[model samples]
Target: MTESWWRDAVIYQIYPRSFADANGDGIGDLPGVRTRLPYLRDLGVDAVWLSPFYLSPQADAGYDVADYRTVDPIFGTVEDARGLVADAHDLGLRVIVDLVPNHSSDQHAWFRQALAEGPGSPLRERYHFRDGRGAEGELPPNDWPSIFGGPAWTRVPDGQWYLHLFAPEQPDFNWDHPAVADEFRTILRFWLDLGVDGFRVDVAHGLVKEAGLPSLGRATEWHLLDVGESPCFDRDGVHDIYRSWRAVLDEYPGERIAVAEAWAPTLDRVADYVRPDELHQAFNFSYLATGWDVESQRTMIDASLDAMGRVGAPATWTLSNHDVVRHTTRLLQRNEGDVAGRKPVEVDPVAGLRRARAASLLLLALPGSAYLYQGEELGLPEVIDLPPEVRQDPAFHRATGQDGYRDGCRVPLPWSGATAPYGFGPDGGPSWLPQPASWAHLSVEAQEGVPGSTLSMYREALALRHKTLTEADSLCWVDTAEGILTFTRGAGFTCTVNMTDRPIEIPHPGVLLIGSGPFDATGDSVTLPPDTTAWWSN
Candidate 1:
C-alpha cells in the first residue's frame, strides 16, 4: 500500500450491530468482526471503517457515545477492540473506527454530573446548556429542530435547555470549552496508542456552532443531506478543531488519517474539511446523491473531482451507508418517480440489481477512494416490510421530516443459511433487526464464487480496480454519444457507461477488461446495453 493509501482505496463500512453476531446474543460484537477480517481482506478492500462500538446506551445506534475510551459491553471490552485492531493489522488490512466528537450520550459521566450539579456548574459548560425561553421558561431555548425530529433542545429539571442536534439522548458538545477539546485530544491518543489506523469522525462538521445559538427563524426539517447555511452545522470554527486533530494524527506512525462525515451546502464547502491541514478525506455525498442519468452523473463527477483537486485532496465516493437505504432499492424507487401522497410502488428487483451493478462499475472506475457499505456487494435491498414494532431508528419514533426508516438498511447480514438469522449467529438465534427470508439466496455462502453473483462481480471489479487505478490519478473525459458517459484514466484504459434505456453504439474503446453486463462488439465499435458499464484496456 502507498503512504497515502486512502487515496483511491476501497474501504468497507461495518455496522457492528448487524455485521455478525458471534456469541448468539443477537448483537454483533468485536469478536464477530475479528472473525470477518479475513473476508474483507479477501474482498480486496484496503481498510475497514467500523461504526461506533464505543461505550454507549445504544441510543441513536451508538452514535450517542457515553465514553470515548472504552468499548460498549454490547460490542466488547476495550481489550477486545485492541485485539481486533491488532488482528486487522496482522491481516495486512487497516482499521478506522468511528469517533463521535459532536455529541456525547446524555448518560455520559460529564452530562450526568452536569445535570446533578445544576446550572452554572463547570461541568455544565462542557455542553450547550441554556435557559429556556418565555416567562415561565417553559419553551425550548431556540427553534432549532433535531435532525431526528422535534426541537433540538431538551429541557432539564434545572430549567436549563441543552442543545442536541440529533436525538435528546445525544447532547451537543461545547467545543469552545477548553476541557472538551482537551478531552477529545486525549481520547484520540488513547485509540492511537491502541494501534488504530485512524478515525471516521462522526458529525465532523458539527462540533462547533455559531455564536449566540441563534434560531433558524422558520420551521424547517433538517435532513442529513440538507445543504444551505445553518448556524448549528458546518460552522467555520469546526476547522480549527480538525486542524488540531490532524496534528495529533500526524504524531502517530503509519500515516494515520482522519475522514470527515461532514455534510455541507456544496462540494466546495465539503472540500474545506479535507484541506491539506485538516482531515485527510471528506465523503463525496454529492456524487452519491446524484441521479442515474448521464447528465447528472457527469456533472457531479466533474464537480467532485474539481473541488477536491483544487485543495490537493483526493475525493471520496460512496453509495450506501448505515444511515440511508441501499442503492439498489433507492435507484428502483427513483425509477418509479414521485411517490408523495401515493401508495408505495412495487419495486422490480431484477431492474434494481442491474442498475446497481452498473453503478458499482461506475463507482470503482472513478478516480478517488470508494466506500462499500456491507451487504451492498451481495445486492441486498432495503427490508422495507419490517414491522413498525421492530423499528429502532430514533428518527422513526420522532417522525421527523427525514424518511426515518434507516433500520431497513441496518438488518443483520446473511452469511450462509436459508433460514432466519441465516448464519448471522448460532442457529435459530435472534437478530436485533430481522432479516428478510429472500436473503437466503443472497447469503455470502450462496454467492461466494458464483460467476454471475453480485458478490463475485464486486470482488472482480475491486481486484481489477486496485491493480489498474491505484497508481493512476489522471481522469480525462472522452466524447461519446448522448446519454453515455466515457472517461480515460491511464494510457489505454477507459470506462464507459450507458444510461439510456436503449442500447447505444460507441467506438471500440479497447480490449474489454470487465463489464457490468454483456455487450455486442462489431469490428471497431461496441453496443452497450442500457444500464450497463464496461472497462477496457489496449
Candidate 2:
C-alpha cells in the first residue's frame, strides 16, 4: 500500500470568520489567512483545514455555499482564495478547503432557477423537490426534521415541497441526479487545478437517502448527531460517491487527499468512508465525544485504532471545533465533556485549562494524525456569555435546535492588544461576535514567548512530535496505578497522564521532555500532578 501524508499529518482547522480579519470588516477573509500563513508554519502544523469561504449568504456561516467556484465578497474574491492557497504553499503548508456537497445555499443559481421554473422544470430535478402529502398539499412530504430545527421540508409557492436536511436556506442536493454528481466533479477539478491539497467534505455520509422518503417516526426531538441506521444519514450508497471523489483526488500530483466530516453510528461505519478506494481520512468523532477519564479515553482510542486499522486507515483525533463548546469549557462542566446533556454546575476554569493541556499531549502522542482547532493552542475557553442580541447561530433561533447555542465557540480569536476585537481586525472594528474581555491575557502575542504558556507548550510539543513521534507507529499500554495511564511509543518515548485529583508517582527512568503542568521529580521517581500529563525520553 502507498503511504499517505494525511496518515500522520497534523491539520489545524481555521474558522475563517473568527481566525483573522483584514480590511477591518469584522469578518475573517482569505486575505487575512494569507497574511497569517507564517504563524501557522511557526506552529508546526503540516496543513491547515480552512472552513468554507465560498460564495454564500452566511445563513449557516459559510456552509451554505451559493457558488462552489466563487469566493464570497465578504471573505474576498476568487483571486484572494487563489492567492491564499499559493501563500500557504510558500510556507510549506498544505491547504484543505471545505466542500459542502450535501446541500447548497437557496440563493445558488441552480436553486434559484429551480424555484423560478416551477414544479416540473428539469432544473428542479437537481434538488429534492416533491409534492406535499396532504389533501391540499399543505404538509411536508415526510417527518424528517431539519438539523437546525423544525421540519426538513420547505414549501414553495407552487404547492411543492423541497427537502432541506439543515436550514431552509440550505437545500439538499439530489445525488441521484446525474447532473448533480457531474456538477460536483467539475467543482472538485476546479479547486484541484487551483492547487488545493484536498477537501474536508461536509456531511460526507448524507448525499444519498433511502429510496422512499420515510419518516423516522420517533416522538422525541431529532438530533443530527444521532448516528446509526437512519433513512437520511450514512446510507449504504454514500460510499460510491466517495469512490468517484477518490478518483478525482488521484488525478492530482503530490498525493492530494480528501477527508470526510462524516458522522456515522460507529467507528466501523466511519472507517468505511476511508477504505482503500474512498477518502484518505475521516474525523473520529466517536473519540472526540468520549469523556475525559482514563478508562473512557482508553476504550474509545482502542476502538478507533482497531476499527481504522482493519481498513488500513490511520485514526484521527480532535478536541474542539466550530460547532461544539470549546474543550476548555467542556472539561470544566460537571458532565466531563458531554455537551449534549444540559446540566448546570459550577465550572472551574483553572482546572479546565490544566486538563485541556494534558488532553492535547495525550492526543498528540497517539499513533495517527491530529487536528487542532484555531485558538486551542492558546487555551481559549468557549465564550458562554454572549449577549442574546449578538447571537447568530441558526440553531439558537430554532425551538428544536439540538445544541442550544454554538456561537460561544465561534467568537473571534484574540490576536493582540487589549479590549474587544482584540486586534482581530486591522482597523480595530467591532467583531462579528464579541470576544470576552478576559481573553486579553490569552492573545497569541501575550503567549508567544512566555515559557509554560499554553501556546508555548503547543509549539514545543508539536515540534517534538515531528522529530520523535511522527514515525513511531506502534503503541503499547504500560500498566500503572488506578487513575493514571501510561503508554510507550516505539522504544524511547513514553507518555504518562494523571487523571485523578491526587498526584501519582511515575517509576519510569527518563528525562521529562514536556509536562502539562508543574510536577516534582526526585532521583528515580517523579510525581505527576492532578490533571497533568508528561512526555519523556528514555
Candidate 3:
C-alpha cells in the first residue's frame, strides 16, 4: 500500500540486438537506443529496461556474459551505456538494464580457467563442479537436465562434469560459494555506480540451488529443463540469495528496483522472488499462460491477489513477452466462454489488431507495473518466414525443427515498413535479424497518430492510464456473462468487452467511455458489435 515509484510505472523492455542497429551492422546497439530515446519518451513510460548489452560471445543472444563490467562490441562500449543512461535520464525516463547472474557463458575466462586448472583456480568456485570418484564415473552424481534440452552437466573433457541449469553454454553459478555471491554483488554495484536505475534479473528464483543437490522424484516425462529426479532447487535457499542481494541493494541510496523472471506455476514461490527487499516484481505469466475465458482470468487474478496478500508483494501481469507468442495469437485461442472440443475458431482477421490493443489495455488495468516488450504497441506479430540461415535464437536452434520457438517474438523491431531498412538501417547493411513482409504496415513511423492504428491506440491507452494511475482503486471487474468481460475502473467507471464477432448484450453500464467498434447501451444491457469491445467511465 505504500507509495513506490515503480508501483504504477509502465516499463518498456528493449532487446538491444533486435531493437535497432544504428551502425547498420545487422545488430542494434546502444546508440540506436539513444536515437530512439524520444520514441520511448513519447510512449509515456516510466522506465526503459534494456535486455542485456554486456560483453558476451552471443552464444545465447548476450544472456551468456563473458565479461560483466563492459559492453559487448556489438552493443557499444561502457561509455555508450553511460550515454544511454544519461540520455534516458535527460528525457525523464528511468534507465534499467538486465542482470544475468544465474549463469555465464562457457567461454568466459573464468570457466576456461576452471577447466584448465583444479579447485585452486581463481574461477574455480564460480560454478558448480563435481568429481566422479568411483567406477570410472559411470553414474557420476545426479540426474539433471539442461534447460536447452540436454543433461545439465557436460564433461569438462577433464574427466569431470559441471552443472548448467540452462544451456550448456550458460553454466549455472554456485551461490553456495561466498566468493561468487560477492562477485555478483560487485557487478550490481558497478552498474548502480554508473547511475543506472535498477535491474531486470534473469532467473532470480534459481539463483541458489539446494545445497545437497538431491535426486528428483520419479517422473514419466523427461524434459531437459526438468532436473526432477535429480534435485528440486526451487526451495528455501532462494530466499537467502534474495536476502543477500537485498543487502547489496540497501547499501545503495537512491530509488532502485528489481524484477525477477520466474515462471513457477504457483504464486507463493513467485511471491518469494518479490519479497520486499528481494525483488520489486515478478512476471505474472499466469495470464500469458492462461486461456481466454472469463473463469480463467478471474481465477488467475484471485489466486494472484491471494498470494500477494500472503507475501505483501505486488503482482505483475503480462500478456506476451519475447519468450512466447504475442497476445493477439493467444486471443485467437480464447473462446467466448462457450463450447470447446471443436475446431479452433479462427480469430476475425479484421479485429486481430484490436484484440492486441485490448490486451494491452487489460495489462495496464492490472495493479502492478506493466512490462511491454519492444514493438508490442505496434501490434507486432510473431515472425515465421526467416530461413534457418538467418535464425540466431538458441530457442529455435535447440528445437531443431520445432514450430514454436521464441525467435518469432524476438524478430527485428520494425521502425518503418516502407523504408528499405525497415527502420533498422540501410538496405545493404545487415540487420541482426530479418524483418518479415507484414512489418511494412505494422511499423512505428507508419502508424503513429493514425486513427484505428495500433500505434495511436496504444499511445492513447498509456496516456489514459497516466491520467488515472493514482485513481486505480476505481478499477474493478464486475460481470462476465456471454463471454463478455465488464469491469468498473475507479468509482462509477465501467468497461464491458464482448469478445465475439456476433453482436451480444453487455451487462448494465453508463455511457461508453471508449470503444473499438459499434456499441449501444440500454438500461441494463448493451449490444456490442462482433469481435469488438468498449470501455465506460461515469
Best of the two (2, 3) by lDDT:
2
lDDT per residue as tens, model 1, 1-538 = 4688888779999999999888899999999999999999988889999999988998899999988898989998999999999999889899999999999999999999999999989999999999989998999988998888788888888789999999999999999999999999999999999999899999888988989998888998777776358998899999999999999999998999999999998899999999999999998877777888988888999999899999999988898898877888786676432221111235788888888899988999999899999999999987888788988888888854355778888899999978989899875687999888899999999999998789988999999997887545588888899989999998878999998788998988888888987767557888899899999986
Indicate the residue-level lDDT of 454 in model 2: 98
Name the 10 consecutive residues with the lowest summed lDDT in model 2. 337-346
TM-score, each model? 0.97, 0.97, 0.90
lDDT of 3 by residue, 247-335 (tens): 87777766777788765646786787877767777877666666655677667877887787577666677777666656665466554
Model 1 segments beyond 4 Å from truth?
335-346, 399-401, 521-523
In order, candidate lDDTs are 0.88, 0.87, 0.72
Q: Write the per-residue lDDT of candidate 2 for residues 1-538, one digit (tens) a residue.
A: 1257789999999999889999898999888888888999999999999999998999999899999999999899989988988898888899999999999999999999999999899999999999988899998888887878788899999999999988899999999999999999999999999999999999999999999888887844555456457798899899988899899889889899999989998889899999999999999888777877889988998899999999999999998888777788776674643443222233687988999899999999999999999999999987777777988888778865466578888898999997878889998889999888889999998898999999999999999999998644588898888898889899899999998889877686498889899877557788789999999898
RMSD (Cα, Å) of model 1: 2.0
- The backbone clash count of each candidate, in order, is 0, 0, 13
Model 3 ranges off by over 4 Å: 1-3, 119-122, 138-140, 217-232, 333-351, 399-404, 417-420, 426-428, 471-475, 516-525
